[model samples]
Target: MRDDEDLPFVAALYASVRAEELAATGLPEAQQRAFLDQQHRAQHAHYRAHYPTAEWLILEIGGTPIGRLYLDEWKREFRVVDISLVAASRGQGIGGAVLADIIAAAKAAGKGVSIHVEKHNPARRLYERLGFVLAEDKGVYDLMEWDMARPSDQGASEP
Candidate 1:
């Protein structure tokens, strides 16, 4: 976990799922390296962007941070702008369970919940099952949202 290479499992997950699409539009090897270098700096610079004004949660198993879910209100809905699990730890129901919990919480808060899933992401099925529909499609990713609770069953964000 010390070196970025330790994220091979995570990288592999992304690669195996979309290597062809990525290679077709992404940079060459050296340029990709430079891009990653720039991304490292940008991630640090925009750390706060990872957590918006809405409720955010860290997905952890046994106290280890495996992933994150950021929620922010927009147009009366709570949007999950980002979510990523360690490659080794994905597909074990963590993402789905966390998603369900977040949706439940959003319902109680009188806010709808949404997230963007890549076109080829395996998690897309989970979202669909959870009642998310295509709110928008940005070519690479789809904006999915759900308004589960009726007005009578909802209120405001919990303090």
Candidate 2:
């Protein structure tokens, strides 16, 4: 991210990710915004502390910020620490395209890509379509993995 300059936009993106869940709480708009801001800070700190070497990138288009991708490379796998897109940019194949690039890169490196996805996340379908499989069930989150070593319905290295 662009540090302080992108703080507000990134926080807003984080809030958008939880907008539906927070809306269900019936909290007033201001309260929801405050809570989401706090949660976003916490998440940012957690990821920074845990994945100190991870690439924290801002997805941009025409010099405008649209999303963020946090990825960590390990010896055997690439961990998608988190990926979030602004509300307006979602459901338009941007995310899928980004993930396909990630998959392709991992395949080239002879490593697997893995992400922890919420069980009900709509993106899970996209991951599945791209050949990610359930590697583990961690309560609310499912760990999905894609490895070039495995046979994929989507031909290997087609990303």
Candidate 3:
């Protein structure tokens, strides 16, 4: 989980995720970087204020920072607030491993695991493959959920 010292890395991770999208704006490099930095700080503050008790985790590989995972375990469900990886870290199965762990923990506690995924996000496929089904559609995003109590062959084992 993150502590005060991890904020810089967390902000960098956030900026990395938006690099491509911000680039598309045709803004100057300096401006784009500044905008991303400001946005990242605001987002960090928003998450802290809203999900005060959420676990803020930094995903590292060989001591190198690669991604971030934020989770909130409520009385009835385990909510995945956010999970993001740098471009170099994507498609490496790290996310699946982390999510599998979360699933196992949720199962042990008899709680469902849920995440809100953006409408066209690639991660949606990963969620579906891991047994998360659409619970609701919030226009821009869809609420996906996996209940441990449900009977299925997709039980948490691997992947």
Please name the candidate that would achieve the greatest lDDT relative to the true structure: 2
For model 2, name the residue pairs that clash: none
Give the per-residue lDDT of model 3 (tens digit) for 26-132: 99999999999999888888888989999888888899989989999999899999999988888878788788888888988989999999888888777887889
lDDT of 2 by residue, 1-159 (tens): 635577778788898899999999999999999999999999889888899889888899899999999999999999999988887788888888888888888988999999999999888877888889999999999999998866356632222
Candidate 2 residue-pair clash tally:
0
TM-score order of candidates, top first: 2, 3, 1
- What lDDT is reached at residue 31 by model 3? 100
Per-candidate TM-score against the hidden true structure: 0.65, 0.91, 0.88
Model 1 segments beyond 4 Å from truth? 1-31, 40-56, 149-159
Pairs with steric clashes in candidate 1 = none
Best by TM-score: 2
Which sequence of candidate numbers ranks them by lDDT, best first? 2, 3, 1
Candidate 1 contains a number of clashing pairs equal to 0
Q: Model 2, which residues run further than 4 Å from truth?
A: 2-4, 155-159
lDDT of each: 0.63, 0.86, 0.85
